[model samples]
Target: MPLKKLTYLLLTCLFASLLTGAPAYGQRTKKTRAQLENEKKRNLEKIAETKKALENAQAQKEVTVGNIKAIKEQISSQEEQINLMEQDIDLIDMEMQDIVSAKEGLETKLQQLQKEYAAMLYSASKNSGKLNKLSFLFSASSFNELFMRYKYLQQYTENRKAQVIQMNKVAALLRERQSNLEGKRSDKKRILSAKVVETKNLEDLKTRQTAMVGELSKKETDLRTEIEASKRSVTRLDNLIANIVAREISRKNKERERLQDQEAKIAKNRPTKQPAKKSENLDGAETALGRSFGASRARLPWPVQRGFISDRFGVKEHPVLHGVLINNNGIDIQTPSNATVRAVYDGTVKDISEIPGLGKVVTIQHGEYFTVYANINQVFASVGQKIAAKETIGTAGVSSGATEINFQIWHNTERLNPESWLVPR
Candidate 1:
């Protein structure tokens, strides 16, 4: 092939090779942007919910433990929002850097193309004075040489035109990249402004929380009494669920024994198998239901439509009382007054009872797993009724000057953290 054709082919292959590496990088950046946006959306939603809950608590005109908890949650979400903004700024910076680098590369390419085109023009002009195009071709020794000369001139002119077009394209692309870089910078500036506002809001929430805690600390004696009453309520609910679950296990065991006896009478001479394990002896349907419920870990819907956990599971020191620890059997969700409570998963209503200081309670059983919803004001489902996921069971009742509910999950007699079971907000 001619030198000009070979050079064109080599340049085309080089451009193609450069283009082939773009999609994977683009896909990765797209995924990162999507994830960041999703996280920010979730953070904002939590902030909104916490704001509503705080508004409801403030409307009561009394600073209670629930109010302080809501403020703390608000502060947490606000800080998270600010962090997300920082992440956005960081991502934009990275994008701008890439654009700057690409713009520089395009500028360099355009310069090279212009330089080459100028050199080609100078060479053609110098040769033009020596022999005009028609004379140059006709002066060849034979018709074949003349034809070859004509083809060379044609390719040489085309190469210069191609260089000029390429330079124009690179310049246009550089302009577009500059525009994109400016856009990213503008985005970073906007997010930084929002972040400043969020930081201020977070500081305000923390100040309010400190004031509430200081006020609560003044009522240490009353707070202690209330804490004791709440513990009693938790103990009562725990016993209720334990007794009910025990009875359920006994019933299943009796039914299994009855079947075994009937089988024994039918096949007297048959060899007896070893006693089945406790889990194996349980009803097959119950076992399957337990498996399904277990499989749904971290995917179950919230019992209430909107709320944040005011109190987490396990034992922790009280926020106001010095050296005082509160043992929580379940997570406490702070929601709006009379907010409807729904079942997190499909189960049968095992028990519903009212206890002192805790309002009404409803317990649902999913095979060996049991979920208890307490602090309910009104119960809608009856005992032994089958309930589906997100089915309304009752409405939350007010406590601690704010509306809230205690939600728990248990496997047989062992308590499981509701936070681990429920999906992230």
Candidate 2:
């Protein structure tokens, strides 16, 4: 073959490989339509839940700081949903751009393939007549030349047929690309419409939040009085928990002494000098309960499945009262009205009592550790009744027009931060 023809063939092969071997660089990292839709669904669910909580908070005729706070939280959740929708819109836009670019590339490739096919057809037409083709073959100078002419004619016809096939393949690919681009453009339009609706909803929530805050701000004196009442309730709860812990410790100590006396009597009757193992004489059930509860720290289920911590454990500046510090031994979880309060762990109810400011309270004992659930309307578990983990103990009571439960954990006499022990919300 001529050097020029050999070089041309090599270049064509290289170009074909370049077109076929192109990497899909951004395909793996890009989020699919299903993934984006799933995220939007989750955000919508969250907004709905927040709305329900707000409705429950506003059920009472009188408005309180808790109600205002719930409205503010709902506003926050709506804002998050809007942000997520914005993200979805942005992703759709990016995907649309990519589709447009890919379609343009495919169109350009199709045009090139059509031009190549047309050129081949024009060359074939120029040598159209069979008489002209026969004369050209007869004009060869030698037998070898004639054979080369025949082979070249055969190869040329095959090349023209291959070019036509290539053109059809490119046309099909171009059509597919166009279809995909249109679909993406449609998706972008829908996403933009959804975003507009979400944006309007977000604005409405903000307006409501502002109104709630303004209403609460005008009642500063009433808010201060409520805070004082809450402080008194917290104090009474602390005292009650302390007394309960003391009584429980004393009871456990007496039981330990009795067990020791019984072991001693058995040992005295034994004929062997070897001492009995502690595990053989001690109550395994009592010891195991404490160990199991302790082992479940940071893994314990929430007392209420759906709620937010309105008041966290430890001392902090009051939300409404300036210069006032409120100390919390346990977290205050605010939930929808009539929400069922469940036990965090398996235990026996130790006491059921009512304090001056707070409502009904239930204390459960898991060996050495104790759990307290307060601000409840009705109790389902009585004193000395065995309770299972996540079993409903009572219905949450409304306080200041909002349902809030005070949850606490104690190991013997030491009070623990319930937030640290409970699973993250």
Candidate 3:
């Protein structure tokens, strides 16, 4: 029973080894890493947005320990499978060594058997020519001795024939097994290399997952605190702006009263012809302002100092995820996130307001031209304020997420596409 179990175990190991060897061998069959790499790199920029989102998500709390555990489990499973494949290959190698030894032994025996067969065939031919085989049986002294001699000759011929046939069969089987073992050798090597790479990738993924979970644990608390602080700041800013607007309106009323008194004196003293010329000039000024509203593309100025348009103004499909369309009123510039958001041209500040969905937006008016810079994190100028070209009017507001500056070009009420102005990336 012990012998039986041992034999069974040996057979089971052999069978299992064979099953494992195939997959190890199979892994080296095909790959396209360069294609995969080219695809991945030509594409990291697109995921810049996703990375930004993940960065924001990191600051939040409520990281599920379960998800982290699951990732670890998956990594463990892959490692276990790799290990099994390695063990199976090792067993197969041992089996191959045994087969190799058997093959060598069989080869030696085959050579010896062939030599014996060759000698027998030669003897048979010589005896046929000289009649030694016939003479041996006929010259026997007794019938029993002659019968015994005949039986010995017959058995010798039969044994030689059987050995030649057996040698050929064994040689064939050995060659076939050797060829299979050679294949297994290459297969085992390939599988080992693959497992090493996969193991590294798994380790990297696990590390990232663990780090993400850790970050998430702190991020939630931080986000809540940030949100509350932002609300209070927003409220305070609103009240301050209201007071500023009231003061400005009062100042404008007083200035208008002073201008009216000067105008009344000038009306009594100036010539009638001067008033006619003044009226015509006023009409022309109004017409010029109206014509400048949403003027030709050539009149527009670039927004940022040193950047190209990464994305254009208009409706277009997303670069990474196909079939998804994005509507953009203005172009997106590719530059460092920390870069300053400056005025595109000389303009007067029109309205600075916190737009719920759009963040803080600052509207500036240049003659009759209007520009809107949205998603502002900080503002340096206020309403009814004068700003020069390239002035640092506001700083971009980032949500600890993707830092994007939403900009708009408007002429009074007419909106112009920013794409027409900015150079394409």
Candidate 4:
């Protein structure tokens, strides 16, 4: 209501607003930092896993495709780690700058409060004498004026106390900001140090990859033979999966036709035309399951607990052979020997078969979708058995010169890229 009180109220509101708004930026920055750190941790774990796979492959005492793949994967993860470190450093720098700016603003506010308090103290000293205070009240023209003078003195005293409290709070906040800045600097230093180690590791991996590729190039003749054998195994597995999938599709089609005929007979028996409920169709569950699985695109868990993709879907040039291409229907995941394989989604085991060089295979039907896990050493799922997501299905087998499994996702007849469906490593 009074000028001084109104001014004080406005200042308090402004300060409160600033305090409330500040955390939004800080929270967002903190979230970004956390995300980067988490990604970096995952990347480091991937590098460690790839290193173990490489060590196993190297035990053969000669360069192999598996060894080369492991080296490349390690290098990729190492590079990504370094990149994350750089991003972390940048974030730290930015946050430090913000802290500096905030500290400066707080210091300015503290100084302003001190100046105002000093002025109040100076004015208060001039009226320190009891006679002066009484003279001022007595000099009022009326009782109302005198009462107003008394209230003014009380408000002035309260404002001075409030100013002191504000100054103390601002000073404390400044100290906190300075400490945070120091912590950020330390974080940046640590990331920079880790970056150095990661960069060195990356270089080492690159050297190993180059040497392995060179060595394998010299054995191109044997490489071709290996490729031929792998191709035959792939071809045979493709045929088997195709046949199984076709039979399943045909069976579902016949059932759908039978349902359609039954629905027509019921409709004919009705007195009036009635619409067939879509939910009653056999494809209802399939549609719902397909939608659920599709919604989980890029979020499905890996078939194995720990592994890196050694070979991707579609066709790629052979690592050692010139002008030669290798075609893959599914992505190959390289894992530790006897790694337990699991279903990526809820499905029913539709078939279990074995190829000569590819070992055993398990095919699971998820509504209209089918997932094929080949190169399995053992199968834990039987045909017609219901499987839940992440349920252990089998153990990985050594195939194509590596302990890995070929993972494929199919939409009835069309093959989908398994990596696209899988979560990023």
Number of the predicted model whose TM-score against the real structure is largest: 4
Query: For residues 217-328, could you state the per-residue lDDT of candidate 1 as single tens digits?
Result: 8988899999999889888988999998899899888989987876666566555684533323538888889899999989999999988888889998886776999988
Candidates in order have lDDT scores of: 0.84, 0.75, 0.57, 0.83
Which residue pairs overlap in candidate 1's backbone? none
What is the Å distance of residue 304 in model 2 from its true position? 4.2
lDDT of 2 by residue, 72-155 (tens): 656666676667767766776776666566667666766776676576667678777445677878899999999988877777
| Model 1 misplaced regions, further than 4 Å | 21-26, 132-161, 268-282
For each candidate, give its TM-score against the true structure: 0.89, 0.65, 0.35, 0.91
Error of 4 at 365 (Å): 0.8
**Could you tell me which 10 consecutive residues in candidate 3 have the lowest summed lDDT?**
276-285
Q: Give the least accurate 10-residue stretch of model 4, judged by summed lDDT.
A: 270-279
**Model 4 lDDT per residue over 248-287, tens place:** 7788899899988887787777667566554267777877
Task: Assess candidate 1 and give its lDDT.
Answer: 0.84
| lDDT-best of 1 and 2 | 1
Ranking by lDDT: 1, 4, 2, 3
Clashing pairs in 2: none
